[model samples]
Target: MKKNFKLLMLAVFVAAASCSFTTKSFEDPDKDKLLIDLITYVLEKGHYDAKQFDDSFSEAVYKDFINNVDPIKRYFLASDIAEFEQYKTSIDDQLLAKELDFFNLVYSRLDQRIKEAQTYYPEILDKPFDFSVSEEINVDYENLPYASNKKELKDRWRKQLKYTTLSTYYDNIEDNLFKIENEEDYTPKTKAQLEADARETTLNSFNDNYSFVNDLERNDYFAVFLNSVVTQFDPHTNYFAPPDRDRFDLQMSGRLEGIGARLQKQSDYIKVVEVISGGPAWRGEHIEVGDVILKVRQEDETDPTSIVGMRVDDAVKLIKGPKGTQVTLTIKRVDGTIEEETITRDVVEIGETYAKSAIIEKEDRKFGLINLPAFYFTMQDYEERNAAADVKKEILELKQQGMEGLVLDLRNNGGGSLRTAVDIAGLFIKEGPVVQVASNGKRKEVLSDRDSEIVWDGPLVILVNDASASASEILAAAMQDYKRAVIIGSKQTYGKGTVQNLLDLNQWLRNNDMGDMGALKLTTQKYYRVNGGSTQLEGVKSDVVMPGRYAYLDIGEKEYDNPLPYDKITPANYSPYDGYIDYESTIKRSNERMAKSAELKLIEENAKWIKQRQDENVVSLNLEAYTQAIKDREQYAKRFDVLEDYQSGLNFKSLPKELGLIEIDSTLGQNRQRWHKNLRSDIYVEEAVSVLEDLKLNNIRQGSLAKIKD
Candidate 1:
């Protein structure tokens, strides 16, 4: 499945790039004249003129930008209308005199704004944005014909601008600054004190904005501006000029050049989030998540530099380097003891952040589980061929190997291609409607299964948590609506049921010669379940809710800024699953079992552990306190194992033995075990097996059992 997916994604990337460059003529105005006029103006005024800008540069930036921003050739805003009025005869004068100045002025203002915003960023690190006092601010668009004339609109603008200023200020401050302790000058403000001050400032600013803003539309506009500006460059080339991108890459890829541990920003400190599965940090068994990084130094350096309160990303850059390089990290563990560890860099793979599967066996029944780490597909691989088809093939192979039921694990799956999701869901049910999309009230599209075959017909389950979002929610919601599977896991999914369209900014501004201003991924549509419910902030509720580690954390769709409101639509007609086995009793029994299990109890106890980790933000001047903190967390974590012994009463010694076969290579054998372990933790798979068992038992009890004679 992985191999096929990689190939497919590669194809998609190539196709996307090709499609973007294939030019088409515009319907309005003279295309050649417009292009020449814009190009001439750009050449005269742009910092890099026609001599510096080649054909590739012109096509990439100017043409692409026009294609994205002015596709329709009709102005949507009064500002746009006014701007075009000046350039009616020729845009050359405006471009040379005013437009260049505007771009330069805007860029300069943004730079200054970023700097001003950074001054208050430490506050956000000290105290995160508080949304507890947020109230639903609705807009009365019906009464307000002209937004400029409405008094309420003005008031909304005032409040929104203030919040926007504050938010931008905070983002800039956080993005640019790094916290480091001056060990030699520890006379007045301690690291903790500085962080506290920053927190207070952020909270105060947040409160000021929250108290004033009273309209959702105003808030949305503010957010849109911020996002649009950041997205104006290449997708990976962000406005954050700090060294944090390298750190972010380390975290997302689950690999670092130097120390093999995951780090996160906690208040002001760079805390260890997790030790990579088989990395240097994990091998040392000293550095763990919840351990605070206090100082770092090169192996040969004499003085260990303090890094407390530093931006997590910047700190990560100072730590990570080329392979075989050595660096020393001074860590304050959860128990408050501080220690320094010297580690060498090596290639590390974040194995945890990928798709895996497992098997759940109870009594004589066996269920297969597939846990998708993320809805990730390399762009090039997907466009050449469909990855979902490969997954279906794997599912069939699992079924052929004696799997009776299936569990699709989508915890922390933050969605990918909409097409892939539709295809994947189509694998289970017969050709039918999967999801309904509503846009502009006039356009409603029902994405359905055009395929005619059903891959697996036995009991099915889908496990989701607060992190299960977008495409993940789509599949889970579809199954639940069709009564084809039972949904299990958190109380609700991460309700991100909206779709986005990625627009190339360069293409949009094709005739203007603006250089690549990048692209804008805009929210275009909202997805709805077949039954008509929209999974916006209110995600899909699980039929059986399970305890999750992130229960206390604000996760999912509700946590996003200016999220779209949830609304329902008229129900669409679709055939229901035939003989859908009732699983209420099975759910009850599973809940009862989970409630009694000591292992499950340990998982529930992790909430307190997580909170304790969050609360101990203050770092110590003394090393003992830091070391103790790390030890305490390790002790607490050791109280419960992440993986349980599910094979105590089973017949096999090793995973390969249990499967009753050997793969061609050790890598394949290891992959199979990883797949099996992922499948075992699948709550949905467990529920499905129980459901099927109950169905069988109930039939016998009622003398309605139909035997399939061989």
Candidate 2:
């Protein structure tokens, strides 16, 4: 009886995985089965919490994989989903057997759907939309069901396109009205002509989008399938395709071994998209964005090789190499002038990848504001270019300029290196245990600062928001735990404590048979705060909760799918710093002040309204109704204009040493000026400054009431 049941299940799976809904046959399966087997072995061995590949896991993958492919319900009807559900439980069995039948069937069906769906958009756009109709479209895709039939699917596409066109239509009208309001002589385009333009723009965008989608190879589909499978284990653990790996490294580290300029394949020549901040190209100051690379030459060669029509991957091979190497490129500038630009390859530090400081002066007190965008550090060279060392340098410079208090701005700092976090924490207090890491089977390793001497023991205030993550959470949590720094921002920091190690797939292979299987960024361990709690889901609780936009939104590490469960271990041995004794009373007084401030109350209300508006997806297609909606929103938006307009009354300036770089790099100078301008108008910075004043260590007797008046 059991054997018959097993055979019956296998039969159902075979039938479900075979139906393609297309006449065109998929490419013959080659290394896909092998790839799946290899990935399974790695995930089983490497992932911190490998789940049993049972019926439950398979069902989760079946649902998530489909959503990842067709999120908007534009593809795959209810009939298709019904057919595919037959193998939903047996997908785990197939995966164990290293089968591609399930993936192949879905991939083929999606391709067929895409081919058919691409036709509907152009057809819909060819006709003019009647926006005067009293109808609305529901864009709540999560709640939406797949269309029952072909005609219904076409109608869905029509409504979606019409809504997109309406945005362009309204923007055009607003531009013309603005011109009229400013008394500029202008003739507005007729409604018919305006409709045509909007349709054309929508059509062009659809075509471009479909073109890119169609260009994706089978490997791309495999990547999606692989991630769908792995991310089921944990959000942080997954595979990286070659291009994705490059982008991840660049974005996270902001430094690559390549020529420090973003490149795009533009027809024939590889165009420089944009120069990286503080990169080799930026330092060379010879090549700029919009330059066309025609020829490339290596260090040993006298003659340059033309990469005129080479693939971007192949061209990049000729360009990127080891540090201290030289690569020369003949390029056409935007003005059509041709020149040879030689650049010495070096580790290009992305401007935001490190710590930057500004001396903010208010009421005869100079407070240091360290805007650490990300806690970046290169493992290859631990001592060089880490966030900790750079922040220490910034602090020393600010102190030279008579900085009294410090505001460590961790807002939007999606964190990096863990070692740097410990080191940075050391700089603020007399060092002890900073963080604890626990591997799969190993004992918890308590990371501590051996350094006894403090760098900046002055009154410290850490400014964090929901976007502040990982290493940022560590530093904030440490300081908050030690009662060393006053934490102030949105109620908490972004909770992400898991540590990931990027393992090269080639390292796992005994012999090189399947050429680069890409890399696996597997979550190997979870780190805990020194005070025993893990920031896995529960982020660092702020001392003083302030009003901001992200407060009401589900935007944190906890919001991610399949996150690791938060747990606690025995607390690491650490001591509280007696540097700032008035922190507790200062926080109490601030909360009292915040309770009385109408501005902060108004800000919280505005945050709730924004979240409510974001949750509303259904929109009217009628032009008059749409315009009225926009006007009503604008009327409400006018009330919150005072939120941004609040002046900090803080004077910010770059240190004398950095001002020279500002002179040499005009981009750096312009960015500095812009940042200073924003700081001058920032309400949060003003509030932070007020907090800093209250935190002035042993000198709290001079302060009676907060300077932020009623």
Residue ranges of candidate 2 with Cα displaced over 4 Å: 1-30, 180-185, 264-271, 277-288, 291-319, 323-346, 698-710
Query: Whole-model Cα lDDT per candidate?
Result: 0.54, 0.80
lDDT of 2 by residue, 1-710 (tens): 00111111112122222221211124435556767877889889988888899999999888878877776678788888988898799888988998877888888888888788878988889999998999898877767899999899999888888888998998878876787788656776788888899889878666644544554556677777888888888888877866566656766665778668878765556889989867788767878889999999999999999988665555777888778999998999999999998888887666756678899988877899999998887655777567888899999999899988899999999888888899999997666999999998367899998886577768888999989999899999999999888888888778898988887777766876655667788988999988899998899888888868757877887777889999999998887876566778999987788788778888899989988887877789899999999999999999988877877678999999988888878888988999999989876777788888998475452232122111
Q: 1-710, model 1: which lDDT tens digit per residue?
A: 00111111112112112111111212222332333343333323321101232333323333223222222221112343343333233323333332333222323433332233334333324443332233222222212232332244334333332233333443343433433233443345443444444445545544433222211122122222223222222221122111222333433343446667777665557888767656777766768789898999987788988877554445776788788888888888799998888888776656555454455566676667666765544343554434365457657767766776677778778776677778888887767888998764446899999986667666777888888888889888998888777787888988887776544434536365533333334555778999999998899998777767767666766664335678899777898775444556666776776677665566667865675554442333222343355577678787656535433332111333324433433444676666556445644445545655553223342232123211
TM-score for each model: 0.51, 0.89
Q: By summed lDDT, which 10 consecutive residues of candidate 2 come out lowest?
A: 1-10
- Show model 1 residue runs off by greater than 4 Å: 1-365, 374-383, 511-514, 641-692, 695-710
